[model samples]
Target chain A: MNETATQTVVRLDRVGKTYGSGESAVHAVEDVSLELEPGKFFILMGPSGSGKTTLLMLMGCLLRPTSGVVYLFDRKVSGLGEAELPRVRRDNVGFIFQGFNLFPALTALENVEATLNLKGLRGEAARAKARDLLGHIGLAKRLHHLPEDLSGGEKQRVAVARALAGNPPIILADEPTGQLDSKTGRLIVEVLKDLAHNEGRLIFMVSHDTRILGLADRIFTIDDGHLKD
Target chain B: MVSIARKNLFHDKVRLAVALAGITFAVVLITVQVGVYLAFLANASVLIDHTEADIWITAHGLENFDFGRAFSEKKLYEVEEVPGVLWAEKYFLAFGYWKTPTGSQETVQMIGFDPETLVGAPWDIVRGNPQDVKYFNSIFYDEAETNRLGDVPIGGETEINNHRVRVVGITRGAKSFIQSPYIFTSFKNALNLSYVSKGNTVYILVKVAPGASVEAVKQRLKETVKDVDVYTSREFSKKTRDYWMINTGTGVALLSIALMGVVIGTVIVANTIYTSTTEHLKEYGTLKAVGASNWHLYKIILEQAVINSVLGFGLGMFVSYWVIQVMKRGNLQVLLPWPILAGVYVTTLLMCLGSSLLSIYKVTKIDPALVFKS
Candidate 1:
């Protein structure tokens, strides 16, 4: 791995998250500290209801940590307001969801272009970049296909292209291959691993697919909101 | 951003059509209701608008043009003598019953003007001449009122206030809001039929000289005339319209119907837009997770609203134009003036944007983190 401690893209210090309140409260994540660096595939392995998704959300700035700080590229974000978090995510983080989460209304190319548009890149330049990214993912011929028309693997690939559209340094994927067949899921994992190794990007993924664990440079397991190295 | 909004709105063709239909229905309802009310107001002052007179002198405390107590004919002479007054003529108006050939009684507003000058006469004569009414007991009846007046054809005979009268000419587009057909005649004939004395008249129609100021002439007429109200033609027309539209319950009724149309339209638009937004809730959540701001989501919804409003407004205007054509064939005046058309367009946009507020709130409050769950 080319990653170093000094090259951390995300740092969580004693982070904790709880849902609901008082006696009915569910502690989704307990006090945990970790650092993610670039140029390596990092796996967050856990069983169901193990708080892996919640921790990913905290790192992605989609949720605020209940008690502790989240640092993205050395800037404290847990204390940021709702309005400020989207900018932090837009500039530094990209998200890939379990169900592919491609916009059903947009074509494959358009789904990727939409993310570029959020970053204020538009017109022919955005279109060209989206086309190139789709081609890079071997989906050049499916550019005009909507989410409903594409296969599960194709949909996830489009989602991946969308995630990389803004060239964000940190890619946070939550079970991106969970809905695909084993063969298709393996292909997706290889593509993500290539992005992490060749492009020097950090691929932080949460998955239950143990088959891809051998490919991870580092791995952490979570059980009932507690993380174990 | 705009492209995404457009694609999303157009993604489901059926939903888009249904939404546009809702907006179009709203536009049509509001525009048609308002158009009909405007037409009603215009009809209330139709005679005043078509008349060539500059000043109208009526009895003191005259409320509207439809009803006025007769003043002395001497008022015409006094009004004619005003410095800026070019000419003044005695004009008479009264409501009397007309006996049809079948002996059925129908109310008619009798308008009497001098045949030679032809001032204050119905200008759109479909058949025959205004001068023909100068013949004794001869009258001009509006052809548009054939349905109500039982076809008083040219040269047909009818009784006005029990006096035999001949329809010498047929006028067009002169129907009144009171649902009373207008009967045009010479000054003497109108007075004779209404049982008014020879020396009395209902109004004195005045014309200002070429170089004279209408306001100056009005002031002179007010000073010269006694126990009479003198008003410029525009002011008198407005008063008549206001009386029919405000004091009478007709205006309130029409306005209330128009307002109801607006409310119903707003509800339909709100419901349709809210439904569309809810259907796309998951997609919106995904967009947010991909780093889109609340403002971005709001822009998308607003764009959808604007598209729906503009297209719906265009369709509504097209439909209203056809409706007006049909109304004209039936002899009903429906005026869709450009200003009113513009007003309706702006109103449609406002209605659509206002309707999207709930959907905007719902979309903005969506949790972006939900995209993570399977």
Candidate 2:
């Protein structure tokens, strides 16, 4: 890997997020600071309502912090306006959800192509790139199938392909394998692992499934809005 | 991206059909109301438009063509003496009760003109020669008036104002604006059948000689003729049309109905689009989470609205065409000029675009983090 490709891409400075105010407020994340670099698979393990998802959202620029700051690719993003956040998110961050969240109306290939289009790739070029991503994840034969028509494993693989579109520097997965069987979940983790190690991407996943913890380069745990390494 | 707007709209066929139906109903309602309005105005001036006269001399302040006021028959000679006047003829119009053969009485508009001059003769004569009205006690009945006149056949006898007359000619396309049938006859016959006295006429029709200015002739007649309104043929027709449209309740009623159609259409289309957008809130949230901007979502909804309006307008015009054709068979005139058609299309587009505003607002306010929920 090149010297710059292995550098830290995301940094958090005493980040905190609280919902509501006064006596009824609930703190979802609290003063958790960390630096994440490329070419490594990182895992965040937490029980329900433990704020791992909140931390992931903060890093992805989906939620603004109540205190402290966030930086993506060495640039501060915490103070950016709502209108300016989408461009930074589009160019750097790709998210994978537990439910797949593929547009129900779009076929598997089109789901990936839509994301590529958001990144300014269009027409046949978007199509070819989407096909190559899905093919690499072993979904080449299921390109035309809708989400409802695909198996759980196939759907999750398509979601992975979508996250890899536009070659975002960071991939955030929230319980990506939460809905899959053991064998399929392992295969997905392996695919994500290959993306982080070989393609030099920063793969940050939030999950309670400890079976794949052995594969992660680093692991962190969260409890009641606090983080620990 | 893959025509997301089109695919989203076409995905649910039932919703799309309902949306189109609302817009189509509005288009038909507006078109028919305006069509009838235009037809009523056209019929109000039909006599003035079809006449061969270059100028008309009417009693001062005559309201419309149907409501005639009598001026002295001597005004014809005054108009004929104008420098540009080629000739002039006396014409009379008044309402009289006609006793059908079944003894049922119906009101008719009596038109009197000189048969030799044929200055204001009934057009589209279907049965007999127009000149046949020159015979004494002879008149013309429109073919469409058979139901109201008790099916008067050729050579049939009828009584107008207690004066006996024979139907010597059958005319078509002469339906009056006020739902009264027209009775065409010679000036002498009309004088006997109507309440007008001898040597008194309602109007004097004048023709300008070749290469003569009609405006100059009209001005000279206005100056020479006393206590009468002198107008060119176009001015007289416009006056007649405006009288019916502004001075009567019919115009107000039709315009009100058209305005109501627009309001109802906007509400229906807006409701449908808003409901569809709400139902797809999860999908929209997902798009936002995937970095789709607010404008991208708005474009999808706006495209759907435009598609609905275009398709609905086309279907509405097709139905309106058939409706007008059927109304014609019943002797009801509904004009569909090019301007009216183009106006309806533009109105439909604007209406649908306005309706899309509510849906766009709903989609743009969504929370992108909602997609995080399993």
Candidate 3:
């Protein structure tokens, strides 16, 4: 990989999103333009209803742009047909939620293994690969333990391992540490920064947590749907 | 994937147990009722079961097993002279009631057969002798009905059609539909009570000679016996069963409706499982967040439904067998064949899968980002 000129991995051009209709319509995101490079930790900050989550969803390709275009690997994803978007999201994006999202019934390893299974892996091969990732995240002992059995920090680590398991270029985390205590939150952020700086992942986290601001290489704000510098 | 579906079911012990219990109840209800229906159909042909005769020569217009038209015994001689010749016995089947001395009335299927041929006597008699039935106007009552009547004395006379009839023997399982206690008498006594003349009987039973094919014998008898129908024992039984289950709408209709109860139970299985998935929507969201697709989620849900169906079906069949056994002791008309039980199980599985389909859809449709937002 060429260090500085690795090319922009996430770019949004004049993207607008309007929800509802007539007098009831709401413009959730409006005319937002941005670019995200590899090996950087970025923060999308806003108060509630400021469309921070909406913008993040749009950037993750989990939601379509109501207007304009989204370029990831220079494919112009927004203009692509409906059928092609899910594949793009599956292959290129990883998502983390505030609740430390994990299927409660599955073991930590099984939870990570679900990724490859969706990517069409099955049997001992999926389990073996999941085990390797869990080992990397220092969760080998808790590999067979379900989410309820793991501590908040342990769960977040498992979630992180799951995001990195598929080797997706972009990891979109929505308030990834909001449920954890301050110390655990800091540890969670540290792991996320390692994904961005060391592993050359583009980590875009949406949050209002002030403690997270200094850790980000670039900070973008969405206030009432428009980008705020 | 199937392992995951199973794991999800066991994640909550109480939920799984409750769902299993519902399914079990549905299974038992379906199997037992269907068993009863089948038994009723078989029991209606008990006369055919007891007769050693291969062909029954009944009136030409007869449509019922026990209560068809009676005719002159001359038809017996006609059937006797047919090619592949077989001997014939005259028998009478009539419905009447016997009054206990205390005035408690028990209905009966009064059977009269020639004493010389001794055709279609009770297969098992617990008291006295079959020869005792030779006592003109003497009758045989089943052991169950006898006990039900507070154990009446063996030599006592019960009033039949207002005439004194001696109870010469106690039999077992010779009873008729719920109300009818069975009684066997001599042909002379039957004609006397039925007010019929000599050389006239309700039916003529024909048995082929040892070397003759039974079907050929039946065909010959039919050809020789004019205006009269002669059928093999199996054909006669089928005709009788069909009379009850098919020609008449009563038994078959009731049984088929009862079987649909299983279908209803399967629907409940689907609803509850689907409802549970909705209750755990966020978990699916989490699955999606971790990179699981809708298709992956759907596969497990379908597998979970199948597991529930198979378990429910197995438990139900066991319940049905026990029920059939108990009914047999009650001497109820309830049959539980392997084929019918298998059909019930397969139907139950389809129902289980049908019910769980919606749950699978709901789980698969969940957006992974919902977990992150919440």
Candidate 4:
């Protein structure tokens, strides 16, 4: 376990994020330092305006930190240009948003296939991979359903399948259960935990629900843009 | 993968219908306007094109074939004696009033030619033979003029310039540019009906000998026949068409309307595509976040535009063909040559592609971060 901890998949060295400049500047995240390893589910708990989502975005490579450095897989990413960030995110991270973010026009199967296409998997290979992923998430029966036709829990399951498409090493979920009932929320969290514990992938989730605290292997509490040990 | 471009365009059926309708309207407007303009030019030079003469000798300062001035008949003999002139004949043309049997009068173009040679004679004769015009005071009237000429029968009698004449033959498709019906007669009878004297003629039609060059013969005729313009048939036809195309504002008006259609179609496409892009902006951001490049996004928008253009152009051509058929019944000529059809297709494509730029610009400005917030 000590050897595994030394191999950090994601590291933030004294990272900070500030919006705007001069008098109207807002310090969203201040001097936060952390290291995350594979095969563990880590959760960040905070209230609104606490910068929990901003910190998750920085880890997912969706947002660049205004100050300090962000390292992913031991590669420096905070210094990379905007044009190079998307490739890093595509190869390393998968995002599950609160809204489920499935294309409204495409079916569940098509949504997952689209992501696989981005990963350069197309034709029969992409189709087979998408089907296998959806089936793994227990959505084989609803493969043809559109987002509008699916229930809230089912939509989240499809989103989970999309996030698991390329089998990325890192999974970033921003309030994945914010819009779900307690039972459905637990079901989604259990599936995410399985991917971390059984598949040895990194699961980094941001949420304010204390109910999920028992399922997390590690938890960090943020208040007023600062993290507490 | 999936054809996201096709899916996005087809998802909103209502918007697609509106865009197609706008493009179809522009195509119809442009086709009809330009078609009529081309038809008018064709009609202006119809007689000159149909004549078998290789060279036309008209009075100097001739504006067009329809407005020929009477030159001396002696130029016919001089033209015949030219080095390359195989034969020369008198052809008379002048405007006259035709008093119907019911005493109603309508203006008509009186054309005179030799019946034996058959040069400058009315073709597609439906009622009587060309030799029938050789009879005393015999003439021919076009069947297309039935509306204005009151459907005169084969032996029908009418008065031209107050002189009584019989309609010995009925010709078809000898339409005039100014909508005046053509009345055909022999040179002897035309001299008695019109104001021109027997020794004067409107034009001298000359044929170039097979072994002689028309240009050299034309030059010789130019020197031999003074105070006259000698032109080949093609040159005369072009000159006549250009006279009407430039002097009359009809050409400019038609072209302006056609250009207006292009502009209106572009605006319609731009507005509709822009609105569609704005509505689906969130989906675009999601695609951006999921590893789609800017080029991929542009392909989606531009592909939608090209599909709209092709579908609309096909439907518009169908409607234009139907309208042209309907106009033919009323003798309103509208021609869609192959070149014009191909030109319209390209124009439609360009209009739609150009209009799609507005939507592409909007998509380029979208920030992928908005997807997480919304």
Best by TM-score: 1
Query: What total of clashing residue pairs does each candidate reach?
Result: 0, 0, 5, 0
For model 2, what share of native contacts is present? 0.42
lDDT of 1 at A113: 89
True contacts kept of each: 0.59, 0.42, 0.41, 0.35
When summed lDDT is taken over every stretch of 10 residues in candidate 2 chain B, the lowest stretch is: B1-10
Model 3 lDDT per residue over A1-229, tens place: 1243388999999999898889998999999888889899998898889998888888877678788889997779887664666677778888877877677878998888877677666878888888898898889899989899999989988988887766788898889888899899988888888889988889999887898789999998888898886
lDDT tens per residue, model 3, B268-327: 777679777886787676555444557666777788888888877777767767877887
Candidate 4: tens digits of C-alpha lDDT, residues B283-330:
777667666677777988899888999999999999988988888878
The DockQ of predicted model 2 stands at 0.52
Error of 3 at B131 (Å): 9.1
Model 1 bad stretches (over 4 Å):
A1-6, A20-26, B52-55, B60-62, B71-88, B96-106, B124-129, B146-173, B195-197, B206-235
Better of 2 and 4 by DockQ: 2
Q: What is the TM-score of chain A alone in each candidate?
A: 0.96, 0.98, 0.95, 0.96
Q: Which rank order by TM-score, best down to worst?
A: 1, 4, 2, 3
Candidate 3, superposed: residue stretches over 4 Å from native: A1-5, A79-86, B49-63, B75-89, B96-106, B113-197, B205-239, B246-260, B289-293, B364-369
Per-candidate RMSD, Å: 3.3, 3.5, 4.6, 3.5
For the predicted complex of model 1, DockQ is 0.58
Q: Is candidate 2 or candidate 3 better by lDDT?
A: 2
